[model samples]
Target: MRRTQLRRWIVGAVAIAVSVLVFLVPFAFILITASKTTQGASLLGFSLPDKWVLWDNIVTVLSDRNGLLVRAFVNSIVLTVASVTIMVVLSAMVGYILSRRQSRWNGVITFFVLAGLIVPPAVVPTIWVLQRLGLFKTLPGLVLIEATFGLSFCILLFRAFVATIPRELDEAAVIDGAGPIRLFFRVVLPLLKPVIVTSIVVQSVAVFNDFANPLYFLPGDQNATVQLTLYNYAGGMAANQYNLLFADILLITIPPLIMYIFFNRQIVAGMTSGAVKG
Candidate 1:
């Protein structure tokens, strides 16, 4: 018993050490660097700022290029909300259908869904298609791209969780004269709280933090997402504005970090529910 307890304690300590080194340490470094002067941050040392100016750095970042950072934040919020909403609704409907139905096409549909997870997006082709559709460099275009890219994973998550729900509820709903839409919305969706929260939190982070997609699909300054606005500090004054750059990174990172912190338990529960057998 003593040996078992000692081993558990050692493992727990090791995990804590790893977590601190991996997450907390890098965050501390960012905080310290973001607090420093231009030359101090340019040095990129992990030590504390000689003269802390964190608020000034934050203000400069926020007010730079006529409040570009503010615009980027609004664009990101809109993109994340629209993309996640589309993903949740469409994926949930598809997941419910896939879970409840026993069609012969299930295997083929499943193959394509799995393929979506495996296949790297063809950027050039996607760009060409978007241009043809008059959506390139548009927020709506980028929203669609984000939604499409995230849909497969969300579908799989919803599908797995849907399987855990008893079908007796479905039968009862149908008996009560509920239509297909009514059945799903009134019955299944409410019970999908865990997976819905999981999908929203996970996909919101991904969409908000997405750099490559917005860079490729939405190029204009007018449509800049928060991640793309990082380039504002990368040229001309790059050597002198590392502090502002880090401050911008810190600003954009906070929303997703707060989401994860608040929903950590729900994420674990949702993921575990999808993992175990119904």
Candidate 2:
């Protein structure tokens, strides 16, 4: 028993060390590079800089192109908030219905929802559809695209969580003269806090970090997002403003990092809370 215990302890220690290295190494490199001069950052070595220029890099990134970085921040925030809000509410309602209903069409709907996970989106076809709808190159169009791509996953998460909720709750709400909307808002939504928080954090991070969807669906200089600011700092083959690029990367990365740090426990609980049946 003692030998087995010692072996387990050694394994756990090694796993923890590996995990730390995996996260810390890249983050440390980014931090070091962000603190260097443009020439120093171009070297891309792991060594500490002789002269720290972290503040200068940040100022330059923020002030470039008459404050394009600020505009990108605003665009990213709007996109994330709008897309996530719509995705969560719609997915929750759909998931609840799918979880409770036993109709024939439910199976078909479920199949399609799951198919979204398996299938890749066709960009050209989507662009054509968007153009026909008069939504091409619009923020609302990008919001819809983000929501559609995320709906399947969010619905799956909510459906599993909703299954773990007892039907008695619904019956009791009905007995109290609650309608569908009222019941969902008052009883079901309150109970769904963990999963909701998980969805919000996960989807918010995904939308905020999204580069391709914004680039393809909402292409415009005025519509640039935080991720696109990287291009501004290091554009074309000749441009090599490594210091500003790293600084921009670090700034954009901090929000999601803080979100994960704060909501990590909730995310774990939300993911696992519905796994076991009572």
Candidate 3:
């Protein structure tokens, strides 16, 4: 039995190693392709380049006359930051109230939130509503759209985590003449660290990589986001510089890659910490 378990572990490790290679190989090709000359890149040579064009390509992409790539990058950051901030606050507040205070409508609220998990967004209707409200084609409109999508998930996480926090703290603080605001911010919020960290990781990745919302709501050359910037890689006059295009792709992908590497463990812990006896 011990030998069998050991063999299973070995097989699992080997499978994981191979999976990593499969996932990383394309990215590896991107780096090599990005550094190579146009001829070398086109030849599919998977070795060091004789003439490095890395810096030149970077400058060209960055300094494009249209300034679309850089503008898109900045827009993505704005969308991600604003969306995440609103999501965290709204979720935490709603979660706290639902978990901490007793209410007759709690079940209805929970049902609604769970239903959102399965609901495919009605995009055309959403756009029409936004337009009616005069929120079309604007940064604030996009931010609100992201926050709305994130609301249910954030609230779910917050409630699950808050349930694990001892209710005695609230009672104790109240006995000491503390108000609800003080009790939550000064006492309870600090204890929700694990779950908050988890939400941050999950929501951040979603908002950063969000392509559909940006495409639908903020569609324009000037408002293009990072994911949209990949269109420049098309195999035509626009996609002439495959090397530079691959390099720009590499640049756009790096920040999220670094974040996941550093915070993946925390993300998992936060998501699950409130699940079981939290």
Candidate 4:
């Protein structure tokens, strides 16, 4: 028994160490590159800068060619926040109905939602559809698209969580003269705390880091997002400013990274609670 436990502990420690090293290596590389100067960067040196140009690089990246980075940053914020908002509301409503109301169409609605998981997005066709709908190349349009993609998974999460909540609560609220809206807001909704937080954290991260939808749907330097900003920077800035490019990458990574670090526990708890309860 002692030998088996010892072996398990050793293996677990090794696995954890390996995982941490794997994560740290790329992060270290990015930091080294981010801190390198134009000349030092050209030499492809993989150490901290002899003279730190991080502030200079930041100022340049943000101000270069009339503040494209600033615009991109703002665009990213808008896209992420707006999409998450729409996704949360729409997904929660759909999930509530699916869980509470046993309509004949429940299975069909579920099948259609699950279909979103399997059906690969027809990017070109989707763009065409967007154009036809008069929704192309705009932030609101992009928000709707992202929300559509995110809705299914979020609905599943919410439905699963809500399934664990008792129907008696709804009945009790109704007995107390509560309307459907009041029961939802005052009674049923409050019990969905864990899953809602889970949805917010998960969807917020995804929408913030989204690359392709923004690239294909909303194409313009003026509306460039953080991920798209890198493409523009890499193509325009060239090798001499690769360090600055690295700086730009770091800038874009910070917000999501900070959010995750602070809320990681909340995310884990929320997801686990919802999944287990439902």
Q: Compose the digit string of candidate 1's lDDT tens values, residues 218-275.
A: 8888888899888988777574688988999899989999999999999988888978
Model 2 alpha-carbon drift over 4 Å, by segment = none
Model 3 reaches what TM-score against the true structure? 0.90
Give the TM-scores of the predictions, in the order they appear. 0.98, 0.97, 0.90, 0.92
Q: Show where candidate 4 strays beyond 4 Å.
A: 1-12, 43-45, 236-240
Clashing residue pairs in candidate 4 are: none
Q: Which ten residues in a row have the lowest lDDT in candidate 4?
A: 232-241
Cα lDDT tens digits, model 2, 1-278, are 99999999999999999988999788889889999997898888999999999998899889988899899999999999999999999999999999988799998999999999999999999999999999999999999999999999999999999999999999999999999999999999889999999999999999999999998898877999999888876779626778788899999989999999999999999988878652
Off by over 4 Å in 1: none
Candidate with the greatest lDDT versus the true structure: 1
Every candidate's lDDT: 0.93, 0.92, 0.86, 0.84
What is candidate 3's lDDT per residue for 154-256, written digit by digit as tens?
A: 9999999999988888999999999988988889888888878878778888998888998899888888888888777656676566787787888888878
Q: What is the C-alpha RMSD of each candidate to the true structure, in Å?
A: 0.9, 1.3, 2.3, 1.9
Error of 2 at 60 (Å): 0.5
Candidate 4 differs from the real structure by a C-alpha RMSD in angstroms, to one decimal, of 1.9
